[model samples]
Target: MTNHRTGAAEQIAMRGLLGTLNDELGSPLAPEWERAFWAVPRHAFLPETVWLGDDLTTYARGTAPQTWLSTVYADAPLVTQINDGKDPGDGERWPSSSASAPSIVFRMLDLLRVHAGHRVLEIGTGTGWNAGLLAHRLGAENVTTIEVDPSLAIHAALALKHAGLEPRVISGDGAAGFPAGVPYDRIIATCSVRQVPRAWLEQTAPAGVILTPWETPWLCYGLLRLTVDGTGVASGWFSPHASFMLMRNQRTDLRIYRDVVRDEHVPAQSVTLLSPWAVTGDDWAAQFAVGLQTRTVWHTWHDNPGVDGVASRLWLAATDATSWAAVDWDGRTDERFTVWEYGPRRLWAEVEAAYAWWRQVGSPGPDRFGLTVAPHGQHTPWLDSPDQPVPSTG
Candidate 1:
């Protein structure tokens, strides 16, 4: 898969993509990165077959050349592999690796602030396009990327080679940052993480930056950038715009009926003015604020419970499956809804309190939040400043 712009058509496509990226980023790419962008075409790094959109529809370059080329230039993520590269059979399909959206790719690259001589360690080299771009800008010797899946790593390495770039692609777990590449000036994780790995902090140089997408059990959003001191601690603030898959090692595989609720359990019923939709609603800010506090709970919506007078129910359960709550919405009213609580801990009350706190504080967005990872790997999430720590459930 040699990389080249065939003729006028390919050059036109490249120009269109550049314009789209510039508009999305709200600024033109730095001259250096702009050169790298043209030097390494994104289509060269993608597989012959790529999945597009949420349904994972297949698009093959060999067959649908025009459609595939157009889709490649779109400002959207293309799923490269699903179910960790295994045939899901009849099971549900989930994205394991992808070529991240161009907008997000450039956004993160801009945030990195990589200089000419900076050594970078990138975790999760899914498609190798990012590594190729970085190598083209900062030289191949200054960048190293790791991928957990061997096949993906091999494919990415081959892709990088075809694109005339080499960045020392390593096949290993990203949680354990590569020891040989110690004191990296910039450490970035393409996948989101629940907890910052201790190795990442130890491997970074003094005043280096570690940028990774952040995830909590309650909500998976936000990009956290922490600046590491020469000491073991690192602290930074969160920014908007991220929805990457969780790191393979940090996934929680708990089902609502299979793992949480029991048939014999009798839940205590009550009433509350707080609506379930208010906390777990479409508002990402509210969900993000609640998630920072209720770190262990996940949710499910039961649209048709089959119970008469019960139009819908929102189920909330702790990650350990020890505590659970359900909020029932009748067809009539929004002022008060029925709440059910059944475990040692009251999950609904915690959510209500978390929501109240967020509202009391003017409902800050992701950017206003920050985290401090201590020397011993203790993460304390704060709002605005370190002294004002947000309430935690766990």
Candidate 2:
């Protein structure tokens, strides 16, 4: 089947997709963005094969054209590459690259607030669809996008070419922002990062916006929109419910029982009444608060841990492979929960303190907290204002 969207049926499908996206996103799309949406056809940028869900069922256009079309138009992320494009036929490997959900794509672009003639630098040129949109909106010559994966980059370049867009597409480390395109008015990253690279800040024009997904080991990712000051500082607050795949270079491999502990290790036992759910619940605000305090810890939940009664285990491990902790909760018990800690850092203790701080601050959400990236590469998380650092749990 031809990849080009030239047939009458394809045009109709594109229009229907636009209508659906408009309705789902609430009302008419932003005027400028709408034009770009119409100009850049998403179907043109998709790979012949894509993956869906944990099972990673391969959806190939040749076998199921209708399914392919539906998936392309849907408001969901499409995994374009898995296990860094080396998973072969196995679906067990982690997903590495994807076309971000359309809603988030537009949301991040809206946050960018690009003006006419403003130059833009986009990190992670996954499918080139995003670059095509930005190029359509603010002239192809004004947009520059870099992808780390060479194969993905080449594919994106070809796709952009097919779509009649000519934004600069380069293959290199996205963490090292393309300096040739320095002084950009806006910089956006499709991937998440643990630290906002110094190169990104240096490349951005003063007063320019740098938007990316910032993640802490303590919690999930948050969208950070920071404005660069000429004096070598960037400060911004996080938006709630924002997350993305971590940047390749910044991905961590810390895990408990596998990398952090040994069979001979012994943990101190303690019992506390602090309800497990309060800290490890669906409340993102609580999670973000805890993350800010415990900077380099990863956690996981194991439910029904082979116990007689229904019980849940919350495991915490340091990225450095130095400390680990576990909190076990049985549904019947409300007065106390079992906690085990090994290594120097008491993970549960830090979590309890962090949660307490979160409550003391009235359980503020991500928007209430801000981050200031200093010139000397120090990241100081603050509450409400830049000068007031959120009290440390350390």
Candidate 3:
């Protein structure tokens, strides 16, 4: 499709999406915000295809105009990069860039409570769309975003420049907050973080807000809104459900499990006990449970021997190698898992406990939870209520 046609279609979609979002949010989204949404061409920042399959082979690409349009405004994420580090040639499953869905973006913005003049620091500069929107509201000079990947950082910077908006775009580790522009009025992270980084709290101004998706043991993601006290202490509630890629360094290490789990050790019992398909498709419940109990460590893969059907292998391990669980799947048959450990607690049992906790809470939505942060080395609880202190399980 021609650029004009694509832009026209995007405009229509944006108007409709904004209207729907406004109705759902029970308030009119700010006009300037709406204008920013309308003005940015989302597809310009996306790649030709996005992998939507369990494996890297399958994808949803922009082969046709309709296909591109459908993928662009479908209220779903479109991947822009895979395992080429910062390049796009490698046919891997890693996702480096994405046009985050409109609803999720709006949810984060709503949590941010960004006003006309709030100075904001965004953690992930994926497509530059988010930074553009913030720049529209707070003025270009007041927004600063940090991206870890140098190639992605350059692309995003060019994209923003093309859109005629300028924000202090830096290529650096977002985990280390942007210090040159310290004490921001608001800090919003577009990436998912296993732990709230200490730099964020330290850099936020007094009474400022820090909004990001907090990793949890539930099936859904939590949008945490924290209020900084200017003393490296912040507390607030988890306001919504959203997800993002884990911080670059915090990504799960799959080396050991990938090497250990082969065809010979495929357990027959876990075959039916766990669904391979369901497990691969973003099982936040299982992922978060394993993350909390094992300190953000896990590995999973499918077991396919010769011409026989497919089974799955799940290895839950800790950083210290103190605990591990090997669950196998043979089609749909049950396979008894061998839980091995010499740790303070059984990893699999903790996963089961977290799952049970979810059921006991009536499977509460992610929006109901919250996060509170104190400076690094300072212990504080992320409570469900302002008064109720959540005991540290770590």
Candidate 4:
């Protein structure tokens, strides 16, 4: 499709999207930001299509201008590239880049509390939409974005230029932050991270805010907002209901459940019982469970063939060993669990402890917990009383 036709449709979609966002977000974002959103044609930053599952055949792509605009504007995420540089084309198992869903983008923006004239640094410049919005609010000169992929960085630079904005686009590790743009008023990460990178805390200015999704052991994520204190520590709240892609460097562990857990080889009597659903449900409960019982990381997978035909498996692994449990939802709660835990701590116990903490707290939402970071380290605190700190680990 021609650029002109694509631009026109994007403009119309932007207006509609802005209206919906305004209603949903309730004034955290200013009206002027809408202009930047409309000006940047999202389709310009995307590939033709993307894979949705491990299977190469099941995917979504933009075949025409309208499809591109609709895909870009929809509340759903639009995959921009896959498999990093290895396989930019579709039919790949990996998803390297994407225009995050509109709602998630807006949610992060709202959490950042971006305002006119605030200097911002963005990590993971996927689609460059977040940077575009920041540029609209803070001006191109005041915004800088970094991406690890050289090709994706180039595409983002070209897309920003095509939109009539020229933010400094750097091709480097986002975890390192843009040192040249240090002392930023705000730093926002479009990616998920296992731990708060020391560079992000170092580069941020005193009183500046850093917002990113923190990956938990439960396979769930939370938005951590920290206020940097020129030295290296940041403290803030853990926003509720947030998740994102793990940082490229941190995306490890692709082992399947069957390989890790041993039901036949290991005796079932050695395994302890734990509720997988408790960890996969909502925040407070999940976090509580993870903190108390889970000494290690665990993940659950669910597959349903049809009504009453569901299979669920929970994979539990520690920094040292692996074990798992399986549950069949075929009208009977027939479940089997096995363990080969050789680590200092039991993984299943940790999972149960997290759930117990959730119940103890009466199941508080993620918003109730806050995060604080220092050059010394990062901590989660109760928002109501910032002085109280919650223990956080890598």
Task: List TM-score per model, in order.
Answer: 0.97, 0.94, 0.78, 0.82
Q: After superposition, which runs of candidate 1 have C-alpha atoms over 4 Å from their true positions?
A: 1-6
lDDT of 2 by residue, 229-328 (tens): 9987999988874678899998887666578879988999998778777877788888888998888877888888786654888888888888888888
lDDT of 4 by residue, 1-394 (tens): 2243454566788667777777767663555655556655555566556544344333444345466556556666665666675744545366667667777787887779877778899999987778887787778999999999888888778778877789999999998888887788899999987678888888888889899977655654678888887567787776665567788887656464434644444423354454455566554546533542342465556566243444544455553344443433443453534433433455555555556655676666666766555575544445346775443331
What is candidate 2's CA lDDT for residue 295? Answer: 87
Q: Between candidates 1 and 2, which one is better according to lDDT? A: 1
Q: Which digits, one per residue and each the tens of the lDDT, describe model 3 over residues 1-394? A: 2133345677776666677778766787777667777766565555556655345443444447666665666667666667745454544356655566777887678778888778899998987888988887788999999998887788788878877788999999999998999779999988776678888888889999888876532222556678988577788775547677667765655454454334444332211233333333465543443343334344444466332433555555555444445554545554443333324545455555555555665554444445566676343433357565433334
Candidate 2 vs candidate 4: the TM-score winner is 2
Kindly give the stretch of ten consecutive residues in candidate 2 with the minimal lDDT sum: 1-10
Residue 99 in candidate 4, Cα distance off native in Å: 1.1
Candidate that beats the other on TM-score, 2 or 3, i.e. the better one: 2
Query: What CA root-mean-square deviation does each model show from the true structure?
Result: 1.5, 2.0, 4.9, 4.4
Q: List lDDT for all candidates, in order.
A: 0.91, 0.86, 0.64, 0.66
The list of candidate 2 runs beyond 4 A from truth reads: 6-9, 88-91, 304-310
Shift of residue 190 alpha carbon in model 4, Å: 0.3
Query: Best-fitting candidate, measured by TM-score?
Result: 1
Model 3 misplaced regions, further than 4 Å = 1-7, 19-28, 47-63, 84-91, 216-220, 256-314, 327-344, 356-364, 377-383, 391-394
